[model samples]
Target: MMCFRQVTLSLILLLLGQATPSRLQSLGATKLRLVGPGSRPEEGRLEVLHNGQWGTVCDDNFALQEATVACRQLGFESALTWAHSAKYGQGEGPIWLDNVRCVGTESSLDQCSSNGWGISDCSHSEDIGVVCHPQRQRGYVSERVSNALGPQGRRLEEVRLKPILASAKRRNPVTEGAVEVKYEGQWRQVCDQGWTMNNSRVVCGMLGFPSQQPINSHYYRKVWNLKMKDPKSRLNSLTKKNSFWVHRVTCLGTEPHMASCQVQVSPARGKLRPACPGGMHAVVSCVPGPRFRPQKAKPPRRKDSWAQQEPKVRLRSGAQVGEGRIEVLMHHQWGTVCDHRWDLISASVVCRQLGFGSAREALFGAQLGQGLGPIHLSEVRCRGYERTLSDCRALEGSQNGCQHENDAAVRCNVPSMGFQNQVRLAGGRRPEEGVVEVQVEVNGIRRWGAVCSDHWGLTEAMVACRQLGLGFASHAIKDTWYWQGTPGAGEVVLSGVRCSGTELALQQCQRHGPVHCSHGAGRFSAGVSCTDSAPDLVMNAQLVQETAYLEDRPLSQLYCAHEENCLSKSADLMDWPYGYRRLLRFSSQIYNLGRADFRPKTGRHSWIWHQCHMHYHSIEVFTHYDLLTVNGSKVAEGHKASFCLEDTNCPTGLQRRYACANFGEQGVTVGCWDTYRHDIDCQWVDITDVGPGDYIFQVVVNPKFEVAESDFSNNMMQCRCKYDGHRVWLHNCHTGDSYRANAELSLEQEQRLRNNLI
Candidate 1:
């Protein structure tokens, strides 16, 4: 049936001769294929389908963003880096895409902002090739993230919250809002007709909620109607059009997804936007389980807020109720706990203390997303039965070299729902890596086949690897033509698989109700290369804090910095030889705390040489130093430019293997650090532009994520800044995963809120 459908669509498209690849996919045509050199499966000169003919993409303005779109369009995790000037080889066709600009998360090349199809100002010599990693290679598997892959069916593939009266985090199940369904790439409102509390229960469960509550729909209606009146709606610059879909859903309240429930759709659904009565949208309010209640001072044995003897703890950024990044309270501020010495036993204590049952998975390395503020506790050793983390043996400060990216998180619950069995890998020599195969129902016949490669991103591969018991996905492979997989697994059976990267299995990932692989299964079948471990890069927050100071740099000595755009925008107007630039100088020491080494994505053979710096730079833009206002806007930025990685310091037992002096192999070895001292050129943020009262001076490592690491949360370091014209004071320098104390005013507001919350 699928083949016949494809053939019929092909004939129709042949007759039209103007259909787009995305349009053809929507019509269920044969999957789009990027024809290129076949020697390297991970990278090739890219071609695109345009106006019924295949063509190449010009390298004009092609960079990481464009490369990412090309790689993702081919269904890989992300682009490591893109090659210009025909690195893979020139092609023999018209350039289809040029001046292609993308933010890197578009669903397809068609969706990204670009020049019109087949419109380019270049020839074949300017063709671009993209290198994609199917599963990400930059991340390491620090801890096993095991979550119950709950009951899932095609019926409830995705259910999202649409806020009316209040705002809620889009994917956080702990919040509440109206319910909507995703269909054919558009999020459509579910008709309120025949909707019941039982239906709400099913929607909530699909969103990882435990139960439902009464919604103030009338208030929501009032706020929703008043939305256009006031453009400043708190719900993320509100203004959403309504398109009602699928009326009359009946649930038994026990069905895991809405699949088992009876659904009644009108035959005239195609006519008049017509099906729902009164055009009312379905709304839901759910009770966040005990584990998900916003953090407070509540302890296991305390009824009083003032009795805070054990301190307080809470979770953040969890997909499900009992799962999240762990945060503890100390010294009247929120902070994170280090993952060193953390395990299931440690997670269980946090769970039980928070009134959650027990721990099912002890996640690590900011899997749920890193926290904010200080890392108050390190080397936490918890017994299975500890009443509180304080009752367990633990360190009180950040002396163990643990960074915020290594912050420990947890998923506390009962046994998993057996999602691991629903997904498998084949064609790889080892069990950990392969072309991914997942079980799904086609025409009511259950079978396993390769997934369509469309929007299969880092989060999607993470879920697949987790389900397969692979520690982490180092690459999301789209070129499966090279793999020798199981005989029957080449058939494409799934499409539009979108995951939050926090799902336990492929079953929990949302997909099209009908199979819709844009590039049908075979050659572009979804694949992943898994790893039990990968390198972890952490910026030395302590070093940044200790080395913080101010400098007055003369413009005469900043010709190279000016060439690199390392100085502020005001520098372009500055008087050349007479002016001085105020710089916030700080040393950066990045440590590799993971089991593997951190290497540049591109090899030294391909490194770019800069005449100004007189050195071969490994990464294009490795780090970003920004001076942000209290509300988070860049007031100034660093004079930093292209960087080279090498070990500058290590413990007694570890030997240094990399140096930039002679263009030697460069990498930050495990248990070692690579330092760019404060006195080095381009190591300072040029802050001469403004009179700043308070600001956030932040440094982020691997900001573009061209390479893999264990945790990204700690890659960013932020410090509170106070400046009076002559000098600047830097304090509370915390990693992204650590919580910096709020400004004094916000701190006071926090105390009142905490008191009221308690």
Candidate 2:
């Protein structure tokens, strides 16, 4: 058997000098033994004769496949047939056959071991043994013959194997056509036509050396020279830094060899040629073969002209189709039409588009406007036209601009009217003042009057007055009988007639008859008797002023007038005694008494006044003093103090008066004086024994701050001490007049003092 054959081979190998202890170790031989092929046989199991003994493979799941794999491992092809359990004989050793599957390509017998050996269960009881025979080697002689071929047949020309060695001397020596480069698995010459120090540096870089190191070391230059194969290939002459020929020549450029161009070599005694001088010129040519020109590229074809393309338009559902149906243009390929359906009726839109005036008319067939570009319209429904552009699809390909010289046109009309007239009320009084009388005359006749008051409760008066068919009176008759004793009175009268109770037109009544009117006490008449008895006991007549007569009036009436008028009066009125001399003089001489008459014949009297006085160095400043009456008053003897008083009552009328004054040296002037009532007139007289300085005085009036002047400028006044001897000085009068007393210390000054202390 297989063991006997292996023993014979082992004996034969022992006789030869090639067999050593290592060879014996690899074969696992203690001593050689002889056995026959059929001495032991097992199906689906592997047997090995090792150390002169036979062993089994425990095949728990061993079969023909595993046996074939074991046979092939012993250099046999595969199992010729399947063998069952103990078909040859049960081996004395443990059966290791278990779970074995193989593709029959294993390399050794012992490689086919299965599960743990020698168990009793039949599935685990099967064992494997091999009947292996020696395999003969093929192609052995051919292998020997192949190995006999010399290193020259296996030599690699693609890579250069020689190391570049440096010589001890000879710097910048000429190497004429002496260098070759390995390229494309071949040694090729490098042209030197345009070689330069830069090219030398590039070569030095390819060799992994610094550019300056190669240029400064003579050893490097010698090493480069040794690296060259041919020493006479024309790389000899080159010098000078700026020489044009010093640049490297490249395979892609004018020259293909290093020696084809001149190059500069360093003259330094110890410097080396830094690099191969042709690297910069060694670019691979893109052209085919060795030619330099690149092949010409092909051009693209032109696309079809837009006019020749088919006309197409896209439409959305629900879009109206008529003479104004949406249409697209086929120029430069078809595209959606923009909605430009416009005409005289809708020319406002066209006018907006062309930034023109309003559209006057729509012209077709080039009458008003011409259609130039492709008509792009959508949702266009022109009722004025006959044919829908979209329906006339064939027209899109026509020569006459889509078969229509005029796609659409519009005429615009410009507006001619200017701003119109409007009525604006310039001035009027409120209705609560018993029918505010207003006169509006376009030519010269009164047009409107007795308008309602801006506030409530008074509109009823206006309505009742108008209901009586009476025109507004020419002027306001305040306190007239018409308004007297009436809570909600509105009426018209004829004669002896107070407008306070009548609602009849002036022309409807007798000029001298008793006036018929309405009253706030409930509608009634002057001559007509009331069928119902008057209240047994009338409440005390509530004479509420419907309109504010003065600033001190009720709060509700205060705001009844225009806000500006009320504010002006409130602002200008100052704290001062009323019915003072200056105020009396002011009212007497300046106010228009004729216009202020409350009754037809009785004139209004001036009763209000405001006064203030002070003294400084014989200078008596009297504000609100009446100058018009001062000249007639007698002067007391002791240093008669006098002055030309200037009135400061603002919106109220003003008047001036001259009063002579006298005082002693050191200015025996009174600084202050109390305003007192003199025969129902208030006045401020000089007081003695008062010294010069700053002082404040306040006077209390029955109704302090009552404003008479409603004009904004004249309503308010303020008083302050003036060193200039004026009674009223407006600015900064409260603080003392010492400049140094309020000077603020600077930070730097304080800091300097602190440093000085330190």
Candidate 3:
């Protein structure tokens, strides 16, 4: 409890001092501080002190990494967002840092690679600011409550959901309620003035349900109007003793407790602060996943099948636990939400529905990068209390004017974890290109040293770059002798730094401690060149939709498909070479619309060769196809197993570089697409034994995370499938990305597409 100041812990980490890094000793006295508005504590325009005068840092290329370093230097835990174009107003001093770059792990900004101090092409209009928080120190904990308020103090103490109309027995824990807060020993109903579902979400989270259920706001206002005006009414009687608790309540939806929110306390009972204004008491309902539905306790019955239905919404392609593009399940397919009017309230509704506290930031312009798929929700209007995004008011169709660049993303406040990585990149041409360095304890003292490069691979370098907050590793360098670093860093500290490529940090990678290095010189230290973008693969939905047809193939002719397990379980049970299976065949063209090429994870030497297929399978388990009931239970699977990647076609000016010929490298280049003919062996979903019914057909490319990509939200394509006894009707086939915003769908075309798998 005595560790009251978070800055004290930050100082401890700094004192553990690795080898003298960069020119920190010369500019070591350089200071950093946040200055500007007094209202927002620990948040303001970022200025650095150099040559004894404070000056603003240029926003030329300022990003999350720079903001992170600034926040950590100022003693805050982490950064929420970085502001450019002088968000807090321009300063009146020399610009100190220009084109400044940081990996965010550095104790001092001087360690970062930059264009140079005072050497800037920017002016005052390019100044940057940042917003940081103080309560997210992952490892440290305060035994006593931290009520020590700095410039900003706690907002509220006791807040509870006050159940209305519900019986007292079921209301003890209070799952559904009109919001109330306790102030100075008096409990009062919170005013609905400027009330949003986000406020309801905060109240629901406090009551143990992070996912706030949808409440009929109109019905509640009607009920309050009907009862509150009566002199003898119970609600009207309570007003004699207490008035509205707060004039206005503001929450970002990321707050763990209501006290963390900005609450405008009610003034003494007066006409100045009107009673609830045009609004009534704020009511909220909540449900805890599938386990605790806020309803009256009832005996179990077979009719409770609603509890087993698939969730209509999901988060995808998020690097962390609770952040990603919001996708809604619509008409048997997953699609993205358009960023039209996408803001905190809508983002908060999504976060709450996903069981996260609140949205820390509602990112726009595809900050997480564009995803592939249909943009389902456009101009989504959420008051924050919706059970899901689907419950909010939104445009009906996917044919919105929005593009993938306008895809919306939400960063939710996730629980802070305790794991820390001492890995960082140093001695490179730029911040994103560097030799890897790690702080390891040697003889009870933690010191910086290079990782031994003996047998070091790209997987190890990837963990290093990611630990530094850089993007995917583009190239893993086995030798770092050309790069310069601290003299002590020449000694290799970590040897055999092998990783399975799934680790987020070098600390989680497998390593040896006895210091075994085949190459004595740390020159062979592990290093990496990082890039912000990677290839993403999405299939041509129109081709799949129009080319689909069914065929009955005898078991004898499917020897290759059977070898790959492309047939269904029913095929395995059937008599060998005697029975026939119904196959749903379609032409699939996978295009690479990303910045990089989609290469096979394995090289030519490691590719698995099957006897039935003449070519090598570069990637194992590349794609998946499934036929599911409307409820999402799979009835049949596809012949999709592995992939032999190669550019089958290219843009007019581009040439194919990768081919799957005899012993060749394989990949699908950017701006190119590889197509598989409908008649290709095993390129269909097996539906021989499936009964005639409505079903959902889905396919996912690179179903496993064996390779890194800039975005994976668009890797899956789905379609609505209907079957009568003799034919299969495929419709609404779409990839879940905004690439089709320009393509208008004709109802007749989709409605007329009918065939059987051949």
**Which has the greatest TM-score?**
1
Write one digit per residue (lDDT tens) for candidate 1, span 1-758: 00000011122222223211211112112123333443333466666656545577888877898777666555455788887898766666577888888787766777766787777789888888777763421233332221111112122235666655444542343346767766545566677777798888656655544456677777766765575356665322322323554566766564334533555432222343443635456788754444344445233232322123343787764534466678886765678898755655567567656545446556666676655457989778653445577778889747877676677888764222346677889888788888899887667888888888787766677678877877667777778788776887778877888886556678777888877766776788888887766666778787888888889988899998788788888889988978899988989888886657888877878888888888877887788999898788888887354466888998787799888887688888877889999988889898887795988888888786566555566678777788898888886666665433222334334335446546
TM-score of 3: 0.42
Q: Best candidate, lDDT-wise? A: 3
Candidate 2 residue 587 Cα shift, in angstroms, is: 99
Q: After superposition, how far is residue 76 of candidate 3 from its true place, in Å?
A: 35
lDDT of model 1 at position 209: 47
lDDT against the true structure, each candidate: 0.65, 0.25, 0.66
What digit string (tens of lDDT, one per residue) describes model 2 on residues 1-758?
Answer: 12111111221122221111100102222221112233221122344434323344444555666655554443234455545454434444333334555555544433544443333344323544444322211110100000110011221122111222233122111111123344324443333455444444223222211111112234534543543444542323221221111123322111111221122322223443434443311221010110101134222122211112322332111001101212243422222232122223232233222212223333333221122224544223322111123432222223323322333433332211110111111112333234332223335653432222212121122223332222112222222334332222232322222232122222222233342223321112221110110000000001111110111222333232212121223323533323111111001111111111111111112211112223221222212321111122321101111221211122223222212232112110111111122221122222112223333211111111111110111111111222222232212111110111123223244335335646
**Over the full model, what C-alpha lDDT does candidate 2 score relative to the true structure?**
0.25
Model 3: how far is 158 from its true place, Å?
Answer: 24
Cα TM-score per model? 0.49, 0.14, 0.42
Where model 1 places Cα greater than 4 Å from the true spot, the runs are 1-387, 391-414, 452-456, 478-481, 484-500, 506-525, 569-580, 639-642, 740-758
